[model samples]
Target chain A: MNMVVCIKQVPDSAQIRVHPVTNTIMRQGVPTIINPYDLHALEAAMALRDRLGGTVTVLTMGPPMAATALRKALGHGADRGILLSDRFFAGADTLATSYALTSAIQKIGESRPVDIVFTGKQTIDGDTAQVGPGIARRMGLNQLTYVSAIPTIDQEAGEITVHRRAEGGVQVLKTKLPCLITMLEATNVLRRGSLPDMLRAERAEVETWNAEAAGVEDIGKCGMKGSPTKVSKVFAPSPRAEKAKMVEGDTAEAKARVAIDALAETDPQLLSVIARQPALAS
Target chain B: KSKELPEHLKAYKNVWVFVELEHGRVHPVSWELLTEGRKLAAALNVDLAGVVLGPSGEGTDSAVAEAFHYGADRVYLVEDPLLENYRTDPFTKAMTDLVNTHKPEVLLLGASTLGRDLAGAVATTLATGLTADCTELAIDPNRNMAATRPTFGGSLLCTIMTQQARPQMATVRPRVMAMGEPDRSRSGEVVRERLDMVEEDIVTKVLDFIPDADSNQAQLAFADIVVAGGLGLQKPENIKLVKDLAAVLGAEYGCSRPLIQKGWMTADRQIGQTGKTIRPRLYIAAGISGAIQHRVGSEGADQILAINIDPNAPIFDFAHHGIVGDALEILPALTEAFRQRLAVDRLAG
Candidate 1:
């Protein structure tokens, strides 16, 4: 089996802070890590590779600095890492990003046929969840998103079965290979890299490919030029008058009671909830 | 400024919202988008329509009725058992075909698992732009639908527009927009179609569907009252206090995204930009700092009561009422008071 997992180094969104005065995001010192969801995707791919004799190739589309992320994935037992980064690829939207990624996936398939492609449900920074489907459309691949588990795969028959998270239930879906899977979060815990794998990954030569090298034929379709969605404005959500009338109570118990009273006073529905849920009132 | 459409896209006129239904129940998000779609249609001075694609049954019929009740001027219906479940192939083909036959200036879908799946596929197949998780929708000065959504992890908001695309696409979460009462007297035009594609042509097949009751799922997003804790709970076991309070009030319990990150709770219980965006009647938050990301997710709540050790925590700024105290001691006290105030029939696990 030949599988490719797409990963991106994103800012640790949880640690990102906002400036109190300017109300602008403080991305200056924000450290980047593999998108948390992508870690799940990588783990899924690695597990498949470990169970079925195969190799997993990790891929990314970022700046030259993204090579660091690729090296880290190698430490997790990926056989190869390809970095598709270029000045022309900057300011790309989901459409352009998918175009570049689709080209890169095709180029990677030149040597060996890639049966499956994996990506996180969405990137933390962008959070669009569109790139994977766009790649599938361009490459004519089966797109399985929000996939919780892959139970079975018939390589010879090009068939795969997966559990998909739907609106109100789990859909057991049977699709074909040459499919793209976007792994949902909390499906599996990521594994620790072995000492030998870590050592080999640290010194591994990361192959960095620019737009041309990555088989991007049209420069116009590579970046901002190809992006149809135009961002006209960027601003912060205006804050309300910042003040909280602190509930007066010396002890925790007094404060808790006073707070609940105030909430009921404001939204009587809070207490009416008990009457509504006959089970609670019973 | 007027939006100039090319010769190809000039035929695009009305605004359309996808009416998402499965298992005979329409997702509330679809109605919310329709309520929003009404505005965009009025602004564009065009018809507000809905596309109901599903198995031929009460699901599609009532969805069409509610679409009109929610102010749709017309509805395009595609009914087939093959379209019963949400598979990418049939849904995409049905949607793309509708757009090709009758051009629409704007198309909206909910940002649920099904919506995101079909929207991405349809937009790509039609070669259009799709903005995800939009917070606001309006007709801009240029006569295009300006879809404003969060970017860079919800720290900033950006407005995007598909300048040249025929049908500008966007997705919004369920509770982000307020839905008005439906008018049952309203009715409109219905265009019925069939699924041209065959089941054998579809590669992906649905084997079975295990309902939500089969899993230990947290119903946090739609709860009327929600009590949530943050890292301030300090220890894993302290989460019991949150559960206790939720049990007394018959409310759902959730946590800030970090608790999920720390494995203290399941991912479904996380309330944040990347998790579930909740719109409860009364949200009691304890030990949460209420960062912008968390704020974006929970701001939809009608009233928020934040309890934290720091009075300066940002949560209080937006939270209606607040108490500055340690959640460790406060959660137990609050749970006790609520337990006595509302005698509950069941105790939490």
Candidate 2:
């Protein structure tokens, strides 16, 4: 059971701040890390590999610096790392990104068969949970998204059962092998790399594949040209003209009282609604 | 180079909304899309239709009728038992088949779990582009559908267009669009379609469904009053303050995305673009800096009270009422004040 986990190196969004005047992202000095959600995906793959006698291959498509992310996945017990970086892949949207990554996965499959392909539910930057489905569709694999748990995997039977998170409940789904799975966040805690794993990861020779090596058959579909959806414009959200009505008080308690008073005065119905609650009446 | 819509693809017309139905009830987002779809259809000078796919029963029939009541000029029905529980394989096949046969130019769906899951598969099968979680939808000058959504974690908005794809697809999250009134007297044409797939061919099988227990779940989307905490609370124990305030106000409590990621709050209690799109009358946000994702979900509230130690927290920009103090301290104070006020009012009564 060989698994391939896709990860992305993204700017830490928490530290990212928009400039006050320019309203542009201040990228200076901000550190980059493997997407938090993808860490969970990587961890899931590693856990499966540990349970079953198999190898987990980590894959990423980005700039040369993206190799760092792959190495980090190696540190977390991935068997191998592959970085598909090319100038042609720049400015690719979800569709184009999936195409490039899927092509690389195909190229990887030429050498070794892939039983399962794993991806994060979504990237923090993209937040569009489309890539996993796109890759699955392109490769003709069944997609199990928002998957919270992989309860069992029958390699001999070529089947896997997973608990998928849906709108109002959990759907326990059984799907065939050779499927694509997008892991939901907080499903499992990520494991830290031990000293030997860290050392091996630091010295690991990360495989670098260009567009041609990645077996991208169509150059047109590799980047912006292949992307059907185009971003026409990007702009910051306009601020509201009226700032928050500042409730002034010398102390936190005083401020809380004043805020509550102001809220009650503005919306008296709130109090009446509270009074109607049977639990509150007691 | 600008490519024109090929002659073969130019035949695609009409704007269709996927009327989502589950457990014999229609999700309100379907009506919301119909309302917005009506505007887009009118803009494109095309017919507005609703596509309802479900098991053959009263649920499917009512969904088709309700589609007509909610401004759909026609309804496309694909009734099959395979679509009863919304396994991706059958729903995707049914939807893609309908699109390929009917050739609607614009397809809309709610960004709910089912819609997102189905839309991706359909769009990919059709080899078309799809924009998810769109906040705005309109027809561009080129007559193509322009879908605008938050990008880069909601720091910026980007308008995306399917340059050369037929049946331009987009999914708008629930509550983003305003729901229109249903004209019960209105009726639409019902075009029933047959899905050829059987249960065995579908790769995935639903073993069981564990319905979310109402006792522990947060109904933040429909709550009248909501008190939410963010990472600013600093500790998991501080969540009690937000809950206390919500208890006194007889409201529901939720948290920001970070809290959920940190495992401090459950996924259902998360209020954001990805979680629940809430339209509460009064929303109290504590220790939240109002990131774009969290802001989009809570901005629909009639009144927002934000408390953060950082005076320059982004939450203040849109929040109606703000307190520049530590939420850890302020939340307890607010809970105490609300408790006292409620107790006094009870005694007076």
Question: Interface root mean square deviation of every model, in Å?
Answer: 3.0, 2.7
Segments in model 1 whose C-alpha atoms lie over 4 Å from true places: A14-27, A268-270, A278-282, B1-3, B213-217, B261-264, B332-349
| CAPRI tier for the interface of model 1 | medium
lDDT of 2 by residue, B259-332 (tens): 98789988789998768989877999999989878888889888899999988888889999999998888988
* Clashing residue pairs for model 1: none
Candidate 1 chain A lowest-lDDT run of ten: A273-282
Over the stretch A181-231, how does candidate 1's per-residue lDDT look in tens digits? 999988999999999999999999988899889888888887877888888
Clashes of each: 0, 0
Q: What lDDT score is found at residue B175 in candidate 1? A: 90
Off by over 4 Å in 2: A14-28, A249-282, B214-216, B231-240, B257-264, B308-312, B324-349
TM-score of chain A of 1: 0.91
Error of 2 at A35 (Å): 1.4
- Highest TM-score against the true fold, candidate: 1
